[model samples]
Target chain A: MQPEIQPAPSPASLAREDDVLEAAVRWRAEGKAVALATVLETWGSAPRPVGSHLVIDDTGNFLGSVSGGCVEGAVVTEAMDVIDSGKPRTLEFGVADEAAWRVGLSCGGAIRVYVERID
Target chain B: MDLALLTALNTERAARRAAVVVTHLASGVQRLVRGEDITSDPLAGDIEAAVRAGRSGVAGEGEARVFLNVHVPPARMVVVGAVHISQALAPMARATGYDVTIVDPRTAFATAERFPDTPVIAEWPDKALPGLALDPFTAMVALTHDPKIDEPALEAALKAGCFYVGALGSRRTHAKRMERLAALGLPQAQLARIHAPIGLDIGAANPPEIAVAILGQVIGALRKPAPAREAAA
Candidate 1:
């Protein structure tokens, strides 16, 4: 609880919930479309743990991460769709998926990410 | 997706308050539930369990599936002593995902040169630890053999209910220290929280090895719940 030295605030670093949530707040206040993709669950050798986030603006700009670098490209792409459709999409990717190697989730794990538009 | 909800959530985060952001996927609805408010939540049981474990996950099924994004404050380690053992333990704690702080009133020992890239507060633990707001997410270690320093810190740590309290000493030294603490009117149950003769009995003979043992025990205490004891009168 000691407010000591703030660690590195990178998405790939220790999960900084404040930074990501604050970014979402900033994006909304700016009137830009925002989508929040949260790692709902993980199985096997997932890179990032559950509750990780990747907040994406309509412009494809993002902060934080749900699956490290793996599957983020696909998530961002789906996030854009969610923004347009004003809907939520749950994306599941795994080693068994044909696109797993392409998306770099080749760590022999599966992850479910729920992407929802937050206007 | 409510702006008011997001605003409230950010406010709590700024205050370092524990909360869980429950997002219902199908309807794209989300609500921020704080610690005290969880009991009233429909998902109270799930949220409480998640809060206790400090983890977040999906709960329910089908359209009712909700993502419980837990927002507990980061775990911290407050090492009270700027000795070589502290120099070794601080970074190890940081590597293991703890916000590490070194507290020692001796400015010469608690120098930035000795512990770079970490906060070193030159204040007594009784004064400094209270301001740190030690909680269950925090672990405190007293490496200074001086009872004047270590005892005050241990008292503050135990009173604050830190997840782990460890003091460096031999069995005989701990007994003597306990006698002193007992004189201070701290009950036996409270003193039981201290893991004196500190660390797992790993036969560590050097500073670095002892540091490893300490971190190992701290991690064990954090990861595993303490054994149940008889209820206090």
Candidate 2:
């Protein structure tokens, strides 16, 4: 049976930063080029939803995700390119992918991800 | 900023039920430069005083993107109908953690004499809804299918930005309602937001099943997908 789960205790505070927001803050603090990737849209059994967030540091340290492990590796590579070029970009991931099997993800949904270099 | 100041700002905000945030201005400048505190919970008092004291929001990070999300728990469901469906829906909605309210202008029907512990509003939606702090987190359903009662509440709900707005009716009835809403100057986009057909395509038949489907869709809309990685499930 697919176990029903509710969200965790939320790490529950803005003061006590979670890993993702913390990373976004830290990367910018350290003056390393970074980009924030937010999942703005999804369709057909997507692993995530609009406003789902990811923080990608210039060195490719990732903080959040838009899909079920089926897309971040590729997204990180793309993030690095964004960092180098200093341009915001969008990318999509799906099962029409050669990388799905390697990531061990359910390969059926497509998620649209937006990467913006937070200024 | 100092952690004490941050904690003070946030704790007050949480007590007042507001959204708080922290922002990094100019992308590279860490620590909240302006218009940010350590909480997504909004704050009160001299915002001007605070901003002058070097509390500026991130200059580059435009708009209010939800920063450290704190799931504020389930929204309340204020239903206005003692009809059969309301019976099935009220408890289920409550169980899913909605603070349920049932209203009916009919005293005999809306009597709290039966739904003990549930606040039975024996007034119309227009009367009762003025008190229901309808916000983006609220989920409202008008089960009466009566034009007089359901219409008022539905209008109040739609204008308030309720997260899930629903009305119980068939395609033909909803078509007319849509026209009425448009006449009232409700925009087409706002009307589109209401889940008129209500519930998933689960072939729901009777009241209880329909209630289940309605709540299910509500949950689905509220849900956020799990992170990209879950550490081997």
Candidate 3:
């Protein structure tokens, strides 16, 4: 009988940031459309650091987080558009922006995110 | 965000090498810069500064806008003894974002029950360290006080060019260690990199306090520029 093959485990040495990039590459290899969002800059008590990443697939699935669960929904929504249009976009969220209030960055901080399709 | 570039970046990361992604926000044009290749890049100065500080952010303004996404391997700490100090040190190191591993040949001291969530390797340093792949981003600490165990690990850390190499001992103990290491044919210059009488002289009265001092010294070695000889490579 053919031996059952177990899926390889991710190395314990990989940091959380590395996992996001690794996920992006793995998704692309599977022929899934992917978009990557990165926190470009932050002001005040931002939920995540500037280099934090959130990767989204065409099916609205995501790995990693770009915020304290406050703004990921909006970022993922914007990322689907980026995947469909193949055009990069910059998004801003903060208590200062009225629209952001609806989504709520209730942490009273501002962040700029860059979203791009991974072709 | 080219697939080729993304794959290359992931490959570098998996190998624990540093890399930077320079993205032109306006045009969505991006390129990956390997750490070893940074000195030859056009933005060498700015990128080098960012890499040293371990930060990533936007650079340039308006029409020339770009984002420098720096990816340095997470710093690791390999403690050479699973002693009382290590029990306190491991949790503290983890809280500060360091991946901590404890190595000791004494199975009595290297128990998982003692280390809890941390990795404990009950093997001699000579056998265990070679597989760890010590690198510039790693910090090694020898707390065993036993020459047989600690010396081999210290030698490995020095040869690997680990950013920090510290040992717990008094000044006299270190002086004796230096002579023995030199007798083993290790150059005096290389032996000098070991921070004997380890940790800052902060008058630590207990294991936990000493752990703080040692952690502080490790952070200082990481953040501050080292002397010319150590930085030569």
For each candidate, give its TM-score against the true structure. 0.79, 0.49, 0.90
Better of 1 and 3 by lDDT: 3
Taking the tens digit of each residue's C-alpha lDDT, what string does model 3 give over B1-233?
Answer: 89999888977887788899999888889999999999999988888878877999888889898899999999999999999999999999999889999999999999999999999999999999998999999999999999999999999999999989999999999999998889989998788789879887799999999999899888878766556324521
Model 3 lDDT at residue B33: 96
i-RMSD values for every candidate model: 4.4, 10.2, 1.9
How do all the candidates rank in terms of DockQ, highest first?
A: 3, 1, 2
- What value does the lDDT take at residue A20 in candidate 3? 88
Candidate number that wins on DockQ, 2 or 3: 3
Q: What is the C-alpha lDDT of each candidate?
A: 0.86, 0.64, 0.90
Error of 1 at B14 (Å): 3.1
Model 1, B213: alpha-carbon shift in Å? 3.0
Q: What lDDT tens digits, residue by residue, belong to model 3 across residues A3-68?
A: 999746647756343488888988887899999999999999998999999999999999988887
Query: Individual DockQ of the candidates?
Result: 0.35, 0.02, 0.64
Superposed on the true chain A, the predicted chain A of model 2 yields a TM-score of 0.75
Best by lDDT: 3
Stretches > 4 Å off in candidate 3: A1-18, B227-233
Clashing pairs in 3: none
Error of 2 at A119 (Å): 30
